[model samples]
Target chain A: MMLKYPNGKPYKPKNQTPEQVGTGKVKDFSFGNRGKTLEEEINETNEYYLSRQIAIVHKKPVPIQIVKVEYPKRSAAVIREAYFRTPSTTDYNGVWNGYYIDFEAKETESKTSFPLKNVHEHQITHMKNVVDQQGIAFTIVRFSKLDRYFFLPFSVLYESWCHMKKGGRKSIPLETFESKSYEIIPGYNPRIDYISIIKKFICNKEC
Target chain B: MMLKYPNGKPYKPKNQTPEQVGTGKVKDFSFGNRGKTLEEEINETNEYYLSRQIAIVHKKPVPIQIVKVEYPKRSAAVIREAYFRTPSTTDYNGVWNGYYIDFEAKETESKTSFPLKNVHEHQITHMKNVVDQQGIAFTIVRFSKLDRYFFLPFSVLYESWCHMKKGGRKSIPLETFESKSYEIIPGYNPRIDYISIIKKFICNKEC
Candidate 1:
């Protein structure tokens, strides 16, 4: 028994029970990653992948504009006055199966659409450059209200971006994402297994 | 006249003068990049390439471990206490012409060897991982005293690293670098056209 969209289609994304996905620490999918954000879960997944030789990925450390630093006698240098720098690209990027993969992870509470305002201009340009270089680029959108995660390829996002640039709607509707994106189920070891979706959709483009 | 190493070999790296390399702003190579370091020159070169749509290389921002933050204003969050985090990979990495490139730029005043101290343990593992994944990996060594730049491929560095792991010499002799690495001449437009060296040495591997 799930709710229906205005277009009459069901809004549920392959409903997987917590028993099917969780192992120990993260047993509840409804809480949206067991008290962690989507980004943290993905970072843990990346670490899991790197340790196991499954894949190599990393969240680019958040850029910070360091204004001043103080080196204490026997302590680490402490950054005193600093501001967060505008990110020039996506959050995560690395080598995956001998191919480059760049992606941004975002979460929204909106039920109908994922707003474009959450992403930056330079980030889109970066994704475009990655695509032009034949790299696999995508975005992971998590709808917190629905406890749903979807992996949207750059191709689809680029189209929507272009449409927005041409004076179109700025947000990608949930229905639009429903048809175009791949659903990501949360699990214990890898909270988000987005690589499976990448391998399925992007392997041909890479090889 | 060229200086001689202890073994009586002439120290030379395809000698090119400032007049040959410079066009406008970076004319005085005798100052060794107009008071700018080798890393700065490489960063400028990366920006030049990025602006021209030639490549997408970026110096990963210095990682910092933030322990505290203060909301100084309603808008800005000022980092109060944070320490610099140890980076797990090299300083630079990107996608170039559909191939992945990872590298570290280093400088030394010592005329004998590029000290292994300049390279870190995790960085070596990272370069190995990049090579294992069929990506092009290398290091840029700027001999400041000699005003020479050499792009040493991971293959060459890996060999030295393995030797060190077996209790061999910790530094790679400049003579060995002369034989194995590509000498990069400083230039104006792209401060360090290391990509040219990449084209010559790594293009084949990528293709």
Candidate 2:
């Protein structure tokens, strides 16, 4: 029952209950004290969009390459040996209103700025590729401490990440993000109504 | 070093070669084979499609929930513990020519029939959901031993599966598949060349 990474490092479960483990200083700024994680909220919103036939977006399942499986008599097959595979892209992707939508959802505790290290190189490259294909690529950044959310476009993120890499600031300032990114207010019905912003910013003009 | 399924079954790797797997005896009538596995061919085809700007498709990474990690001296992070997560849908999905395409790549060896078990219930449900939203959904079944391929629509597969579950034939006979499915001729460039058939069968009238 011991889950270890390929290098024998222990894996951390991100889905632990807030009560089971302290919130660890990350202040969630998004609406009420509802303990739902960002991913759970987005998943709920995706379900809402799907039910309405408004879009067909889904969170890509966590990727695990199964190396071994045991089929016991009259029971579900059990995986015995598995290794973690490095994913090449961000989590969520699908089509909406004839536009290919790709995004990564991230939560942060810092109230003043979002750290550049939170965005990986592979993700940036993925966003670039999607944008090159004329697809709408963005990231849903939730400042947990500030309870604020923003949809940052790929171009702006790429520029900021690149700048940070070359001796620039380690984090993107809140003022810059506020000015450049589309603010997404969280709600009960659809936790992250990002597509509406997409319709306003990317779809109406392009498609 | 032990992987256990959620149901407490020990994982074991199937010892059979790729040729020995699946229901290949049915017939050589599935798609995706140029002397390589479907995953490799799909990767190549995705690259080709990306280069040509014809589509934006990708294979979702295998989902692994990491439990423990060891950052050995910062150079490498060795995953010491991880568990495989059950994927809720098919492996590959994306958009092509404004149509949302979703499919699962499967290889079988039986020369007479394809077993109903290879396709999972959740995958069927996902495909149905996609079809309900007017998306193009199908499975790319490969008879690797015979080096033949076929594209079976979700509707046909669903009906056959339902029948199989209700005390009908346990496997889909080759004759039924051949008569209803579109044969995809494998090639060097695209490997599957499925879009051509899609154009012929699914999009020609619209155009």
Candidate 3:
């Protein structure tokens, strides 16, 4: 069965495994992926972090607009009708070493560019709010075709978003990601060691 | 219709408004409440803070486990079967001036004591984790019978939890909240001004 977004658009689940890049020279260091989705990898990494007492991050549960519910006697209450609501903020957020961390994760099939349409306007605004409140905000974008993951800071994404408003490029080119964002190498224990990258930039400087 | 918890117990929706305590000496400062629930009041307060760019706190959406959904040919998807899952963390968490704020809100009808059963063991562990990570963790308890609210710190709650584990009292006396926690008097515009209390404690010293 298929699910639909609030706008009646078919909700496309980005649960596909990473595709092998045909380039023979490129080294595949992401052996831990094991055909897992980006979300799954991140969850695994978060569990690893939590167990180690390093961080306390969690993916916010999917927002559902409950319409009708049935309460059967001697049983649990079952939701009979509900609809998906458009989230106004990012997907993942939590405290990390006394710093607020907020970010959204997306997996794109396009190898050349990451489309701005993947993020909603409210989420951009929400990220701006987080930044204004002195919280760390960013996006984790996985170029599935290339098996490459980039941690795009909110600043870079916001700049591109503003440029898009002025009729600029519809998407951020892969070259920009290569230049501006930090590449998160997939590993075995934590799966995706994105927090190491965050610590290097945030902890060493502002935090 | 009534809802049920994960344990098949009838889910109690604590949406009732505050009642009069019948004490002639008690001045009714909560003019803005307008018979609203503690959750609604806090949501309003968070909105006020967000509008003024003071803090970015939000009540997390109810965690629902989606079992079955149906998508119509030309309409929004409908959740056919879903159940409310036991949340493993606090209900509210967000960033406040770069500080990670995490807390749970509960209202008790009892006038003498607040029962510990209102909070789950997993939530206590989660709060401990947040505090260990240097994040600000607390609980907002509302005495509906007395129309009073208090911000109980995690340390105090943890102590009580440990004591209870040692076969101590199962409930926290109302006097403990009066002395140990900060009382949040309701007001207009923001309704429950809890962040001011947080700022006084956190910003003055550590922040």
Candidate 4:
């Protein structure tokens, strides 16, 4: 089904072949991820965390504006017309070891730099508010081509966002990711294993 | 639009007249809430808290499952066939002064007791998980006919839920609410000032 972003931009699904993803012949080799999107991987990780009594996190449902509905006899209500609404906050949030955790997940095929347009203005504001409340806020970025993932704190992202608004580079370079973000390795059971990276951030604050 | 619960139960909106709500002709006297539902009141309160930097909370968007879409050229995509899905978690959650706050809001016309059917098994389980992770979890129940609101903690709700599961009382008695729950007064600016009640919970944990 067709979907649209909050800005009314048509949502485009990334179409990557094994060679394009650099997982080519090793595709048969199981990293427990066989062409799953970042969302699916993160969801699997969350399930693992929940079952293990580690954390409680969830991706908020996509916001939709319902225009019409049909109630049939004794079955269920069917929405006849609706449109996607712009989300005001980040995609994922919950409690982890008493800390309020909030973050967004995005994937890019570009290996050199991640585009700023992938993130939104209101999302930045939401993250800033989360940080102001002393909640842990960050972004999980996947470099699809390089098969790499990085956890970029909201502080680093906000800095780049402000620089772009002031006519600086529109994308964050790979060097920035190397310097400012923590790389996360994928695993079998917990797919993304992002909570470990978050643990480091918590340690920095408390310990 | 018509909506249904996760258990395929048709959602029934509380229809209370001014007299039934016990506000009588004083309804127009303005509590800053004329005929607003509990969800509306809580939403307004959250907005107030956000603007004042007192707390950051939100009501989660309703879950929807899209079946078909029409992507017309030069215009936004339209969802033609969709249905509301059963939500897996509570309706509202967010951070409040670094605390992971999570809760569900419900309203009932019955003044004697709050019906157990208003909450679901999965919701109880979700709240249990949140509490286990050291998050503040509770339910905000509005006794519409009595014009009263109560902050019922997850533990109290869970006990009642367990009793119901074991063929005990199917509802929580009003006396239990009077004895165990904290009362929340509807105000002019925030409408339902629940954060003050939550502050009491935080203090109990710390002190």
How does model 3 fare in lDDT?
0.81
State residue B115's C-alpha deviation in candidate 3, in Å: 0.8
Model 1 stretches astray by more than 4 angstroms: A1-32, A203-207, B1-32, B203-207
Q: In terms of TM-score, which candidate is stronger, 1 or 3? A: 3
What interface RMSD does each of the candidate structures achieve? 11.4, 6.3, 8.3, 7.3
Q: Could you tell me the interface RMSD of model 2?
A: 6.3
User: Taking chain A by itself, what TM-score does each prediction score?
Assistant: 0.80, 0.83, 0.84, 0.86
Give the Cα error of residue A191 in candidate 4, in Å.
Answer: 0.9
Give the 10-residue window scoring lowest on summed lDDT in candidate 2 chain B. B20-29
| Model 4 Cα lDDT, one tens digit per residue, B101-199 | 999999999989999999988799999999998899999999999999999999899999999989999999999999989889888888888889988
Count of steric clashes across candidates, in order? 0, 57, 0, 0
Higher-ranked by lDDT: 1 or 2: 1
Q: Provide the global lDDT of candidate 4 against the true structure.
A: 0.83
Cα deviation in Å at residue A8, candidate 4? 7.6
Scored against the true structure, residue A182 in model 1 reaches a CA lDDT of 85
Q: Over 4 Å off in model 4, which ranges? A: A1-32, B1-32
Q: Place model 2 in a CAPRI quality band.
A: acceptable
Clashes of 1: 0
DockQ of each: 0.26, 0.25, 0.41, 0.42
> Residues A39-77, candidate 3, lDDT per residue (tens digit)?
878988898999999999998888876656787877567
* Per-candidate TM-score against the hidden true structure: 0.82, 0.73, 0.87, 0.87
Model 3, span B141-207: residue lDDT tens:
9999899999899998999999999999999999999888888987887888888989876754577
